[model samples]
Target chain A: MNARGDTTRKRLIDATTALVREVGYANVRTRSIAVAAGVAEGTLYRHFADKRSLFYAAVLDRNAPIVAATATLPSLAGRGTVLENLLEVIRKLAQLQEDLLPLEQAMIADPTLAPLRGERVQMPLEGPPHDIARYLAAEQSLGRVRAECDPTLAAISLLAMLFGLAVHPLLGNDLAKSELLGASVSYFVDGVGASATQPKLLA
Target chain B: MNARGDTTRKRLIDATTALVREVGYANVRTRSIAVAAGVAEGTLYRHFADKRSLFYAAVLDRNAPIVAATATLPSLAGRGTVLENLLEVIRKLAQLQEDLLPLEQAMIADPTLAPLRGERVQMPLEGPPHDIARYLAAEQSLGRVRAECDPTLAAISLLAMLFGLAVHPLLGNDLAKSELLGASVSYFVDGVGASATQPKLLA
Candidate 1:
């Protein structure tokens, strides 16, 4: 596509995202999306396959930063302190969820989007969990993490913790903002079990 | 008030729950709910205030077991090992989320349910997080938990982990069922950081 086509495509995706966030996925009309993009309805079809494809593109557009950040995680495995590395990952995951969840919840709530759920937008290897698992495995090789711990499970646990934190406020509960991220990381690193005799390896 | 009235109310709530699960909440009609319950439409209003009230009652009815189990958490603090007590709580929470999440997603998707979100159906003290926090605090006082750990924060973390696990499959990801729960609890108790010389305190 030429520069003009690229700009038009970008506009369509941005409009779709805004409209979905504003009126929800179920109510957004393709015609309104074209109007929001300052294009004719026919022009939208020239750039994308359908409204669903446009919405998927919009989701991908919004998720670009997190996907980019996840790609860099494997390289950070042995570079920084494991605690610092995981903390950065947690913060990014939290932010990604914050941006994507409303869109995701809207999709899940719509039954038409059900067929698309089985389709893998991002490969398993490209996911944050996989990248984090790779990072943890590297740390384990360096003896920064426990040798016996399953990196994949740990990665999933960390992902779930961040996901849980994001969803908590949605359920009408308040979390203590001051200590949540740091404290959660600390607890994950040192554990809550009484281990006075154990040397704090991460510390 | 009478046995017949009680039976009718139970049937109405059961029908509402089943209908909400069968049809998405947006698609379910109060009339259909009454029909499913084998009663007249007027009968539903006699037992409950309105359709919203019937839905709320359905949610509460499904949530009763988890609520009942949460009430007993504090008493188990010092009796069994902390690990065993927590595993049971985690299991119950996972089950509660599995049952409640679909109805929750349905409610969140519909705009009509927005007003009810702010209402406190269950008191904060009666929530699983608060109960788990109390259990951890009791264990901390008994020297089973690390003295410096924050019970409330840790409680939230555990709850979040279970919540995260429950929501994972909804997004089309598969979890390793064999090791997930036990490993997560163990990781929470022992910390994933390498403590080569640390005694296995929880073990």
Candidate 2:
């Protein structure tokens, strides 16, 4: 498309993203989206076929950064402190889950939209988990993570913890900023298991 | 309600549950529900005002067992080996997340169902996380857990790992049963931090 057409399409998507975050995907309508974009309703259809299609563009297309960032995880394995590198990935992931939570909620409320979501799923084959697993495998090869550790399980656990933490606020537990920032990373890396530096207690 | 009335109600709910599982909340109409229940369409209205109410009965009411079972987590704190007891709780919690996944999907797809779900939320104040936290606190008091560990974080991590694992199949990763049972428990309890049992490397 021409630059002018690209500008209009970008405006509509931006407006739709805002509305979706504010009112959720189910409540998003073409007229309001067009109004929010400062364009005619006809303009929305010109850019996209329907409201669902527009919503997909608004959300899924924006996930390009996350998908790209996740693809780079494996390359960072031995570059920094394992904990630091892992935390950077975890933070991005938590934000991605948070960003997608609304879309996910909308999909759950109406399962018919799931196919559209499926079509937009980033990394449909393996996803961020696989990247983390591969990254951990690389780290393990470097003798950073435990030799016996299951990279897949560890990767899943890290993502799970971060995802859970991301959703905690929705469930009403206000995690201290520190909890979200360092706690899971510390726990995942160092674990809650006592170390020789700590006191040992009853078995 | 009378015994016959109760039986009919149960039958309707059972049918509705099956249909919701089969087609999801958005596609489940009152007619199909009635047909599945072996009752006339009018009988469905006698039992539920609309499809959403029926969906609640079919899904949320069935969640009573999971809610009640989760409430019992704190009681299991000191009963057996901490790891074993925690595993049983994690298993139950994982199954609950898995059972709720479809319902959550349906709710997200149609955000209008959210309020109905909110009204039906099993633990309105807090949720399984609180129970898990309480359970961890009880275990910590028994000196089974380290003094410095955070119970809430620990609880969240355990639930998170299970939840992430539970959603794995949805993402197309079929984690081995051994990974699900042993990995999180081992990580949470013993940690991956180097110990007298394992070699230490990084600073």
Candidate 3:
């Protein structure tokens, strides 16, 4: 990138990050970003083509590698117990910039953003379920996690718990909570499933 | 209760439920419910105190023990393997009347509805976390779950993933690909932790 282009790109991204954090994803736009950066609206065009493209760039810079590199690794392939490895991932994700939380979700959700989730951020091979499957497989091999257990469902339930902690603190709580921040990851590891009674079809 | 009181209470709830489903929570009010239910405006007052109280009553009805009892108690408490019990709870909760989905979130969110929560229902425990803690304790006591794990975080994470799945289906194609949901949960369940190689400190 040339000096002028590099300067423009930096300003554009800085403005986008600020606007998104100040307002929200739905409201952020190229025009506002350009104005915030004190650049001509057309300068934004020189830096990025459209809102979707700009938004994608922002997400890539902010969350793509951070979340992908960490979350999409061979996470399930831990030497320690499953709980320890899982807590490490949760803490890493929760600690990402608070500004990016809304943007991360908006990108992952919103089918409009689907095209952007491409070659740059390939999905991880050892997804949580795969890890659980590995764990369950290992445990089954060692005779711990029941072989008949639906590893997929177990994975889904566990993931839901982590997402809930993020959401409750972000969307529900009035003030940012330091104490509750790390609490969710810890609670899930304690393992609530083994004692749960068998569920029959509700008649 | 006299016939008039019984009829009035039923009419109010039916009216509010109908109104919310038809339009939305933001648009509905007692006057409209009263008009829809064919009760005089004051008749709405005779049965309910205000729009908040009326809406709270309807919200509770949708979420109350009668509807959830069909699944929550048995599934969460049952002796099934962890995943089986979770799937039972989620599947059943998914089957609840569509009106309830937004209702629970709206009541817990939106400060306008905060005061109403105190009036409509009292939680025996604060919320799902308590149920989660109890469940984890039981599992820990049974030596089924890892003793070192933090049950509270575990419970919250599970709740979060379930919430995302529930809302994801509403948000867009994210839910259509249960693969995404499954992957998310599975990773959380059996993911990696902070290590020298996979650092937790974010940029």
Model 3 lDDT on a 0 to 1 scale: 0.52
lDDT of 1 by residue, B1-203 (tens): 99999999999988877776665565678999999999999988899988878877777777777777787889996676777788877776665655566556555555565545468664221478888888888877766777777888888787777766655434323332336777777788775333436343444
Candidate 3 per-residue C-alpha lDDT over B1-203 given as tens digits, one digit per residue, 9 for 90 to 100: 69988888888887887775554454576688989988899988988888878877876676564244332433344375544444444444444524454554344323355553234364211354456556655555554445555666555555566565554322323342455444444434332122223322231
B-chain TM-score, every candidate?
0.80, 0.77, 0.69
Answer with 2 or 3, whichever has the higher TM-score.
Answer: 2
The sequence of per-residue lDDT tens digits that candidate 3 reaches over residues A42-134 is: 988977888767776776566554445344434354355545665566555555535454554444323344454244642211244455445
- Please rank every candidate by TM-score, starting with the best: 1, 2, 3
Error of 3 at B147 (Å): 6.5
What order do candidates take by DockQ, descending? 1, 2, 3
- Ten residues in sequence with the least summed lDDT for candidate 3 chain A: A194-203
RMSD in Å for candidate 2, one decimal?
6.0
The per-model DockQ list reads 0.42, 0.34, 0.15
In model 3, chain B matches the true chain B with a TM-score of 0.69
Candidate 2 lDDT tens digits, A1-203: 99999999999988877776676565677899999999999988988999878766765766566666679889987776777887777666555555565554454444456565337454321477788889888877766676667888777677665554544324413333446446667767765223445433222
Rank order (by lDDT, best first): 1, 2, 3
State residue B84's C-alpha deviation in candidate 3, in Å: 4.6
- Candidate 1: pairs in clash: none
